[model samples]
Target: MAGPRAFAAAASLSMLFALSPATAQTPPTESIQIGLSTDAISITAGFSGADLTIFGSLENPDPLIARQGRYDVVVVLEGPPRPVVVRRKDRVLGVWINLDSEAFENVPVSYSVATTRPLQDIAEPAKYKQLSLGAQNLYMKPVDETDSPATIEEFTAALRERKTATGLYSENVGGVQFLSQNLFRATVRLAPNVPVGTHKARAFLFKSGMFVKESSAQLEIRKSGFEQSIFRVAHDYSFLYGVFAVSLAMLTGWLGRLIFRKD
Candidate 1:
């Protein structure tokens, strides 16, 4: 028979060998998930400007993970019938200079952000295009210009070679560029001749040439008195003002009649 002490020691050594492995294996990388919050999803249209909120998560199976890397998030505007472009430029010696190396004429409106590490990022791409209701009227205001006024030929040439159209009038004033990334603000001035109506403008984001996400808002343009009357009473003020006016008039007439009868 084996000694009790020797047998116990042997069993313990066997258990240790079974429990421990010779080499460690790395776990698989977890897929990344990106999305916008509910509050971020909803937006009000017909404003001069608005901000969009983006939130996402990078998940890894292993707790020890690397999230420090540069990423590009792009937002794109898809629609409203006529193509639109917003260009940003700097004023140098009274001349309008293109802020972005690449010209954006006939190209969709896009906003981009570059970030390092995992955290919340917030950006507001001000309004460069506003569409009117009925998809007839469109309003575009280009960023302020600083450099010398551009000639029609120069401007036309720039437009012909550009990727997007900056509506009827293009301005290079009051625009700012993103310091960290190749970002800029361009103004697009809509022609006064734009037809009045409601329009739709889409927003989208892209990264590494791949479409990532998208959103949209409505643009309500008021031009004629009839259009303005219908839009204001129906949507803007909800007919409250009209109702109050009618009620007040009725009350005043009733009081006058009662007083006259007593007299």
Candidate 2:
């Protein structure tokens, strides 16, 4: 009787072991989708204070597994002949301030990403990692007659000139190191003296010093009303002061003339 019972128990355990492979062999469902705000975007001349939106989608196919989702979005603006400046404002308490800036002329713009979901629930984090979100230069025309399409030599020369002109502004801010991949935010600040015109900017992705993909965007710098206001103020001040001085002189001369006529 004891031998029979022990053999039966061993047989049950063997059957459970046989079923474990089937349970473990179930494939994980892929539940993520990616889309852009548009297939293409365009910016016209004198464009400023413009906002570009990037859109993406996430879906879950498995009903049993509850999933949490998160994403990291990076926008890089690139220009070939000249470097473009990207700036982001950080809110501290109530005041907003410029947080950081990064310049990319010859090189590509790059940053890292982190999601809100855990690794297990991400479905395919590696797939999201492979997705490229950036731009490239199709063509860059000169803004001025003297200025020509930028060559490699011209780019290098402009970089040197920029360094000399600006004398290196902020290196780091808000405890974020500039040019560090660890941080998600980076930008390139346009020089104050940057010529006022339309400039082409491109965006691209890079891994291990090799180009993976590319896209393109545009940047336009035109005279603002604020600039005109400054000149208006100066002209008004000059005209008012001149009129006041002339009125004072005339009044004095009139008083002298009346006194001499009485004498």
Q: Candidate 1, TM-score vs. the true structure?
A: 0.26
- Please give the range of 10 consecutive residues that has the lowest summed lDDT in model 2: 4-13
lDDT of 1 by residue, 142-236 (tens): 23334234532344345433422423322222221222222212122233233334433332232322333443444443343454566567677
In the range 169-195, model 2's lDDT, one tens digit per residue, is 111111111111111222333323334
Q: Which candidate ranks first by lDDT, i.e. highest?
A: 2
> Against the true structure, what is each candidate's TM-score?
0.26, 0.27
Q: Which regions of candidate 1 are displaced past 4 Å?
A: 1-27, 39-46, 61-106, 110-114, 117-263
Off by over 4 Å in 2: 1-164, 167-185, 229-263
